[model samples]
Target chain A: MNRRTFLKDAIVVITGAALPAAALEWLDPRQVLAENPQIRWAFLVDTHKCAGCGFCVKACKAENDIPYEASVTRTWIERYVVTQSGELLADSPQGGRDGFTSGSIDLPGGTRVSEEEIIRGFFVPKLCNHCASPPCVQVCPVGATYATPQGVVLVDRQWCIGCGYCIMGCPYGARFFHPVHKSVDKCTLCTHRLTRGDASACVEACPFGARQVGNLHDPNDPVTRAVVSERIGVLRDSYGSRPRVYYLGLSKEVH
Target chain B: MKEYVWRPMYVVVLIAALSLAVRFFLLPHDFGVHEGGYKYGYYRLGNIAEWESRPALFRSADDCGDCHRQSESLSASPHAFISCQNCHGPAAGHPEDPPTLAIDTGRDLCLRCHADLSYPAGGRDAVPGIDPLGHHPFRSCVGCHDPHHPRQEVQP
Candidate 1:
């Protein structure tokens, strides 16, 4: 079936099971979804192989016309360093790859090298975790932020009240409130692109294939099975958000 | 107490109806941008498949000055490529709301990329220090620094 038909069917199946009886007849989610699935997107990150290259971050801004000079990162690269003595330091690269010649990264996934400091190091690309059980959804007062059955969390700018609660609730600190839109924002994992079986900007931009996208329920799906075969670690699994993105061969201390 | 009527809903009816609302109305659907000029920009997106009909979008930083029209001093800095979102966050929804939906994540977004002291624009050009107000308890680096272009002044 075509995408529209599939969406309509999925909506009927899920919403027919979720909404209140009073609101069903007037606003049947099923009928609508029989047209679309709302926001359906998810990601799986492999930490073991990420080069800490800021390519994803750079690429996101470039593709979207995101400004080049600000501290805002729709996506970013992190440097994680672990010492033999068990000291851990995490930082985003200070100047990204463009400024990498200096080798200074003091933020998440940064390098801590000195004459005496013996350590292991690597990088991870960080973006919105896009959780199935998103806390950002619970804290939104106007219901602007909501999750799709497929588990992508999104905000409706028209309804947003400018509250920053979603920013606080995000376990990965991924949300960014912007001035132009004057709305709380984060990576949407390029939800619009997924309409035609496209991957997110970050996933496509990475030269290393460190980022993967797919559904967990579908066993044959690469991301679903990779999490099992590769021993992926969900960032702060303790937050209980059940983030879909998984990092492989990650240093425990990096979390 | 009587306001709390406990009528049971049919299992199938209850599940189907609720699922529809949650699946469609409550969630945020994708609204893609169709702005021109990004054959290679971060926001200049395209199909993910390697062999897709479209090529990736990218742009030169100076192109932004045409519309933003910042003063020559602010617009010409090396941090010119730093788009508005680099400092303010994604603006896709900004036009719908004014100055509010875009809550401040504080200025740390700036410091995350550029440190407090010294940054370059082009060809080894440099601007030093992110200190906004030396007196405020918040570290100058944390607040005054505008990462979009550290060479520029802090937004009030």
Candidate 2:
């Protein structure tokens, strides 16, 4: 064959090979997830089982390489104390990294619950809810923060512009601007570990089976079974984020 | 009429072709999914499989049990379902670095499940409760009990 014809044929062959792979980029990720029923992941937090040990918080920090500062935390445990008069006070001291001690919390709501008047109290660990309808994902103008096919919310650090829009948009106060990367950061539900058949860092670190991560689509899965039978609650259900994270024994005092 | 129609049509066609050329020239190649480019480009968010390569810092209970024969005791106890990595921290590099894996059997660690609470009070009876100060005078639970099987006493 002539050199010109040979080159033309080679070009055609390369283009044919590359086109299909390039086309894959345009395929809707949500549609991909919808087709795969096994990808429906969820988080179940039983606050009643949580002992405020702060191990989950510490584990998250170590796993994610997050700063151990009070302001920057991927996950934190909130201690909710109810007074005899029914005054609710919530506080997370140093993101509960040092663990909780018996003490009074100064509430911004201007209600002080002394150690003596404490009627009821519980620890509620908070992290990225990985909402089906994440406001952070919606508000990201650059689409840096996007949910995976498995419904795990992730931040494409390379795509993030340090705009902090996702950080501001998150109502659960999950997203925070990473000091080192200067990009919006939050819990990924340990998508890395989950893909490897290991649980999330927080789930693995909970000595008490307080935190459980499971595929909701699997009928036999413990999380799915619990969700169906148990009266599980999501944080701020009225807001309609449809958060995948389910909570059992969530008190009314918790926000 | 033919002259007027042809001139505008020619200009419109020229503009459209020029715009297409510029768009093709200015647009990025590879969509920057892995290249750290600003735009995902044509909705190319890359493959989910990329996450699979990320290093897993945390190990499962089974992973820990694979090496430690002593972990079998936990399998029979109430904490059977609980992972070994929980109290021992992430044993990413275990036998290679023996001292690196420090097991935290502290009192606070035990209190995390045993602490007394009023809200969500149901079903907590399964896990015992104690006032850290009043009950044991700030003593560690492990000092008197076994962590793997709290119900079973440490046989001397």
Candidate 3:
């Protein structure tokens, strides 16, 4: 074959091989519904019922395989003590795993507020809000963090490059670096237990039924009904993250 | 066509072809945005199964009820809301290798929820706390109270 003819034939073959793969990108696979279309998992925290026992925190650590002594946890309880003078004193000793036994809250720089001066005190539990518009998912350079179809935010540890972008992107301070896995980790809503038809460890450990998980899409779900009918609020709604974790009787002092 | 134009076009097609071939070989079979489109976010599809494969270390109270009859008394008691694993530790492998779960009968276990901070606004007052020092010092709570049925005191 002539050199010119050979070159022309090769170009046609290469273009033909490449065109299909390139065009496939635009084909866009047909949108598949989640395994359970009705499932959109959400969390509820009843500040009034939370006794600051911290059973949930310990349970979460055990269930998730987080180090028993790790300074981080998937969930923690924050004690908000509002003084008579309206000074908000907050502290969570060991993330409330050991429970609050002290009468006074020690502040930074050697200051302490005696319990007698406190006009109001309450416990607020915190965890991944699993926002509808998750900043962590958005900021992940490697697409390591993502929201499941059921509305649970998950971190693919295998895919994570140990970058701290998602950790900083999370406004709720939910994400933490796993010392063992060497990756950014956050609450998975206990998907392992959820799929097994059991409540998350934290929810189950709560003797007061203060924490709960329910399907937001199911109108019959008790949590969904409470969220729709009760005076519920989310943490820092001003940020417009659309956090799915709802709080009942949320005090103003709690951000 | 001019030589310059044709030459650049040929190079562009060659690069595209080479890159596509590399991607075809290197890309994971299950890597892509799947259900719910990009709204659910792009991810490695196989990771879902990987997360699911992680076995749960905690089990439901009903799992314990399958074998232990003590779970029945617990269900009827005021402490029914509390899971067995909460005080006894996680029931990952119980009634087998361990044979029995270690029961945390310490005063601290009960005091976790029973300690008096007197924060009435938080609704913890309903739990009925005590001044651990004044109530009954140097003694375990179970000394007088039946943990299974806390309301009914154990006869000495």
Best by lDDT: 3
Query: DockQ (Cα-based) per candidate?
Result: 0.04, 0.20, 0.45
Off by over 4 Å in 1: A1-40, A83-86, A94-99, A104-118, B1-156
Model 3 chain A: lowest-lDDT 10 consecutive positions:
A27-36
Arranged by TM-score with the best first, the candidates are: 3, 2, 1
What class would a CAPRI assessor give candidate 1's docking?
incorrect
Q: Model 3, stretches more than 4 Å misplaced?
A: A1-37, B4-13, B70-76, B133-139, B152-156
Candidate 2 per-residue lDDT, tens place, A191-222, comes to 88887788888888876778999998778899
Which 10 residues in a row give candidate 2 chain A its minimum summed lDDT? Answer: A98-107
Candidate 3 lDDT by residue in tens digits, A127-222: 999898898888888767898888889998888998799889888999999999999988999988888889999999998889999999878899
Error of 1 at B102 (Å): 30
Residue lDDT tens for model 3, B1-156: 789889989999999999999978887867677764664578888787788777988777588778766756677888877888887768787766575666789887888888888556485678878877788876999999998799998999
**C-alpha TM-score for every candidate:** 0.52, 0.74, 0.85
- Residues B23-85, candidate 1, lDDT per residue (tens digit)? 677544532222211111111122222213233342222333555668675556555534444
Q: Candidate 3: which pairs clash?
A: none
Interface quality of candidate 2 as DockQ: 0.20
